[model samples]
Target: MESHVVKIVDIQQVTHDVKSFRLEKPAGYTFVPGQATEVAINKEGWQNERRPFTFTSLNHEPTLQFTIKRYADHDGVTNQIHQLVAGDELILHDVWGAIEYKGPGYFIAGGAGITPFIAILRQLHRDNQLAGNTLFFSNKTAADVIYEKELSNMLGKNAHYILSREQKAGYENGIINADYLRSQATDFSKHFYVCGPDKMIADINAALEKLGASADNVVFEK
Candidate 1:
């Protein structure tokens, strides 16, 4: 597969553990909003340790961007990513992902799973088509919600925050299960986009199916 070596032009901390990396976009590179590319830091010993990261920048943007969450407990690619700064280089492989926007519907995401929807929602907002879509984002705590202010501004009342660990005012508490889905969603027939841990996705898919949503209408990363 073809790979592009790009330099990190900028870096911004989106949350306590998540950082946004802006990299130089290669000429002729293009990708759908929800697509992701395998990325590896351009350094010895770790150059082959590639990980999939969604493109958070719009296709028309001059540069590429990735919003990554660092898992400090593990000696993994993301943990290494947190140690990088501007001027660092990375190798980006071919773009591929199963998650894509189907239509106006509810977006259910857990923690870093929100990365894939970042570009999709940004593109929709740029085109003024973000009215019918709602986002249900779940995190351990309010501080863990990446781009909370931006998502709220783009989705307005359609943005719902669910905290599974720390419960605070203005945020829903507990896991997003069949009960929560039924109570907050009025239309079970609409499309449902889900992304998160594999188990969470499986559970949500089952819940969606039990709630009268067809398998064909549910979109997720495979």
Candidate 2:
């Protein structure tokens, strides 16, 4: 599909390695909360490579935003994303995704995998659609959490954080495994949005199965 150039409006570091890029949305560009677009860096030897990034902002407006976590040692597209700066230009393709909200439920995320859930949560909050929802976010450490303050303020009492490296009073000190999911989630009937590395997602799925959640209720991002 054809894409157009979007100018970077702002950039801010959300964590040690994760950054959020806000862009001035081009005319006619639109996207949904859980949708993702391919970002193409137009540098030499970078044309044919397009990387998928989820929309971080809730609204489809004049500006677009993406929160990205870069892996330094990995020789891949994410490394290129880390090197981007404001005033730079990147090509954005139309949005697409399969793992989206059918209705509010529970969100299980790990590492940099919370991007889509953030967008969905924001939209639900904005429209007063988030009456009953829970978020279980797992990261290596406190510093690894993205949008910590914002998520805390927005989700408030309904959200929980799990840090594998640091033991905090209110946070769990381990990976979000099947046992964690079984204990934290109140209703297995509720839809589950699981995102992250393969192991985390698979573990959650396995837990959900033990909790009597149907496979159809669990959605995975492609």
Candidate 3:
């Protein structure tokens, strides 16, 4: 497999636990919105610890960006990634992903799963096709919501924030299930894009299926 060692140009804290890494794009390297690649930190003893991360930056952008959340619970790749800074190097593999924008639909994401939709929504907003799309982002708390300001500005009232563990004044307090989906969505026939933990995805997909949505119309990472 082809791999490129790219240098990190910049790093910014996106949320309390999430960080955005802007890496120097390799010439001729390109990927569609919502696509992802295997990434490994170019450090001793960690060079082969590759993990899949979605590109949050648009394909046309000069820099490739990855919006990653650091999981400090275990001594793992994400924990290692949080220690890196600008000028650090990373090994990136070929781009491949199952999630792609098919059309305007409901975008359901959980926590860091919002990474894939970042590029897709940005591309849509850039192309003036953000209408008819709605985003349902569910996180543990307000501090866990990544790109809140940017998402609000870009999506306007179409964005819905749900806090599973904290009930903020402006956000909804609950999980995204059949009840929630049925309450907010009027058209079950429309496409539904979902990305999250495996259980959440399975539950949401099953709920959508039971809510009169066609199985083929639901898009997700498969």
Instruction: Write down the TM-score of every candidate.
Output: 0.99, 0.95, 0.98
Off by over 4 Å in 1: none
The sequence of per-residue lDDT tens digits that candidate 2 reaches over residues 33-99 is 8888888876777866898889998665568989999989977777887788888788888778846
Q: Between the candidate structures 2 and 3, which one is better when assessed by TM-score?
A: 3
Rank all candidate structures by their lDDT, best first, as comma-separated numbers. Answer: 1, 3, 2
Alpha-carbon RMSD, each predicted model: 0.7, 1.3, 0.7
Model 2: which ten-residue window has the lowest total lDDT? Answer: 56-65
Per-residue error at 157 for model 3, in Å?
1.1
The parts of candidate 3 lying over 4 Å away from their true place are none
Model 3 lDDT per residue over 1-222, tens place: 999999999999888889999999999999999999999999999999999999999988899999999999998999998899899999999999759888888999999889999999999999999999999999999999999999999999999999999988999999999999999997887889999999999999999988999998899999
Which runs of model 2 end up more than 4 angstroms from their true locations? none
Of 2 and 3, the candidate ahead on lDDT is 3
Tens digits of lDDT, candidate 1, 82-167: 99989999999998965889899999999999999999999999999998899999999999999999999999899999999998
Error of 1 at 187 (Å): 0.8
